[model samples]
Target: MRYRRFGKTEMLLSVFSLGAMRYLESAANAEKTIWHALEVGINHIETAQGYGKSEEFIGQAMRNGLSKQRDRFYLTTKIGPTKDADSMRRQIEQSLKKMNVDYVDNFDIHGINLYEHLDLVKDPNGCMKAVREAIDQKMLGHVGFSTHGSLEVILDTIRTGLFESVNLHYYYFNQRNAPAVQLAHEKDMGVFIISPSDKGGMLYNPSEELSGVCYPYTALYMCDRFLLSDPRVHTLSLGAANPSEVDSHQDAWDNDAPMSELEAAVLDCMNRRYTLLENDRCSQCYQCLPCPEGINIPEVLRLRNLAIGFDMVEFGKYRYKMFENAGHWFPGNKAIRCTDCGDCLPRCPENLEIPRLLRDTHDRLHGEEGRRLWE
Candidate 1:
């Protein structure tokens, strides 16, 4: 695996890092998978307090035999924002004990996905103070944050200049975070892309139309190549569930040349998708926001884009179902919340019928309520 300097942290990290959230099968399997990732040169291992059994799996792997090779990889774990320093410090200690490690290479304030979450972390006697104390005690190294927040919130978090790195979403399917990525790079912060294959439009099970659009490359590889092509993106978390999945991502390691052809492929896919649907003109301008019912208009329309233009009906319904449960991570209600309010009608540069399209989006992608991955 190729390595890059992880911004201000200065750690040379593998372009592909193993995310341990999906490592819930078995301790033996986790060991095998982690061993395979190390064999393939992946040196960054990330887990979280909320990912069920994830920390235990890594700890088991270490105690079972991998302890001797601990220094070969950098370890990272995260905790959700806490209201007080004492509770946050306790959680940090618990994470260390669970991982069978004295110190972690990085500790991120997890899921700062809301304004209130940020407030909790930045509170004088809250998680930030606890993290600083951990750093001073030699229990944590670089301090960072992982977020699923809005663009405004993300930019604000970066501007705080408190974090050494940031783990956020930026993939082929959703480039809304591009500005935030650029800002992070300018601030010399490590930029980690989260769940590129799964959250990045469920590329693991690409729709037939989507697959055809990315002709000459599998959706997974295409998406991987697209993200790594950008210098600002430091690493991508491969949420591999097994040993074989690690091998599948190795091909992206080759060819460090310009991606002119890949760029053309993306442009072609974007242009052709507009022809596939009637109201394909949302443009995601974001001017028609602050909806009276708090519906995420652009996201709902983007789901509509994927469902109709790319035949990603299942993926659409899956994400659409998370509207209510995802909270600030993916805020807003279903498009059905539109009350035919003309408030957003004039703001749309596309001049599209706002209420009608929202209802249509709801009709196309609505399904049973779904839970967030960590929930």
Candidate 2:
């Protein structure tokens, strides 16, 4: 496994770090998986309080055997939308108690999507002040935030010069976040990539069209290679289920042979294919959110783009499943629930016709069922 400097920090972290999102089914199994990763030289581990039982499982595993090796690894966690300063402080204390650690190497603001939330955080009475107090008290080594906003919000956040790191979605398919990663590098802040492989369902298995281009390597390897190709990406956090998954990633990391010309050409072609999906160009800015009805405009649009861009039936199916299983297929507010108020248009970042897109998503995904459910 190769290690890269985490921004300008003195710490050098593995390019592929262990993500503890799915480590809750069995404590023993999670422990074994984490140990195996450490044995194979994966020294950076990331988890979140929002991920069920992830922090507790890591705490249990470390107490069981990893405590001695603690100094050798970099551990990170995050704080989410707290109701107030008191609540935020309590959450951090709980996180510390659950992790069985006095301090986390990196602690981040979890899931900041709106520009308004950014302003709220920076307010003296807001959560950012609480985080700063904690850092001053030595409760966290570094501070940052994780966002799923547009390039504009990302750039604005980085320019605040308040964070030591930032976590954002990034992958071969989602180049939208690339500029943010570059900006993080320029500002000397750690860049943490969250779920790069699973974001666009890329890691599950590449579509046949993509597989054909990748050839010799499995779709999984191609996805990993694509992300690792960018040297600026400090670490690609993976949600590993077992030792085998960690081992597979280890193999990929060890075999960093230069990309073959065919591989480069294939990736180039894929990028071009992705760029062509500009039907309405939503940009996922989420400026028109909290829709009165409950439509997740950006997600539906993304699925629509994926459906048309890849021309892969299975990919579309997977996206449908994601929506259904995650309770986001038809959100309760925004477009799906819009009364055609026309209130969201003037506030939109991309000025997309919100109601129309929601109607299209409903028809495309559920057709008659969606109409009956919403109408």
Candidate 3:
């Protein structure tokens, strides 16, 4: 695989890093799968304590002679934004023991996904302090964070200069995080793109229309190359569930010279198709903010686009329910809490009927039936 200088960390991060978030094989097979990645020169491994069995699987694979040369590659496992220093400290120890590593090359403050979550992480006596202590003791070489949060919050976390790298979402479908990627570059922080296929509009199960739009290339390959083509994006996570799935994303490596032609053709088709449903739908512009009841208008509207524009009702419904648990990170009351105040009407450049769309969203995507789908 090709490599990029991962900002401040100075690691030659592989363009296609193995994301160990999905593994469905037996221990022996899991070892073989991880071994194959190493055999193919995948040197960066990203996993999390929360990803069930992932860290343990990697540990077991290493113990079974997957590789004895730990010094050659970078390993990162996430731990906190824990509620307290002690809990976060114990988590670090637990992660080390479970992975059977004396030290990690890098560490992550897992899931600082909102403003308040950032506050919790930076708490003087909380996770931030605990990790610094771990670093001082050489338990980990450096510290960073991962987020499924807004660009604003992600930038806030990067600005602190406490982290050496960052993991955030940025892809073809969601360029909203572009500014965060830029700011991280400015700060010289490593930027790792998370879940390009799964969170990037579920490219694995592309719609028939999407398949046609990204013709000659699977929508997945199109999306991977789209992000890889950009100089600012350091690496894209290839979260392969099975070993065989690895080869597809790797083709994007060093094949960027053809990306300009491919992106123009594919994007024109996709933009034209998606534009058909844009008349009254929200542009996810985030202009209509500070709604008195604290509604996340842009996100709700984006979900609406999935259902209306792409006929992806099932996926739309699944993500809409996430707001119920995501708290202030996703923030705002559901569409039902709009209260018809029209406070957001003037702020919207589209001058669309803000409350009316929220009502439509509430009626269509949110309800007891949809809640059960995710619950």
User: Which pairs clash inside model 1?
Assistant: none
lDDT of 3 at 278: 60
User: What is the per-residue lDDT of model 2 for residues 42-141, given as tens digits with 9 covering 90 to 100?
Assistant: 8888988888788998889878878888898988898775657888888998998998888888888876766776786767787877787888988888
The positional error of residue 304 in candidate 2, measured at the CA in angstroms, is 3.1
Stretch of 10 with least lDDT, candidate 2: 366-375
TM-score of 3: 0.89
The lDDT of model 3 is 0.79
Q: Which candidate is the best by TM-score?
A: 1
Q: TM-score of every model?
A: 0.96, 0.80, 0.89
How does each model score on lDDT?
0.87, 0.72, 0.79
The residue-level lDDT of candidate 1 at 70 comes to 84
Tens-digit per-residue lDDT, 353-372, candidate 1: 88988898899888799987
- In model 3, state the lDDT of residue 214: 84
Candidate that would win on lDDT: 1
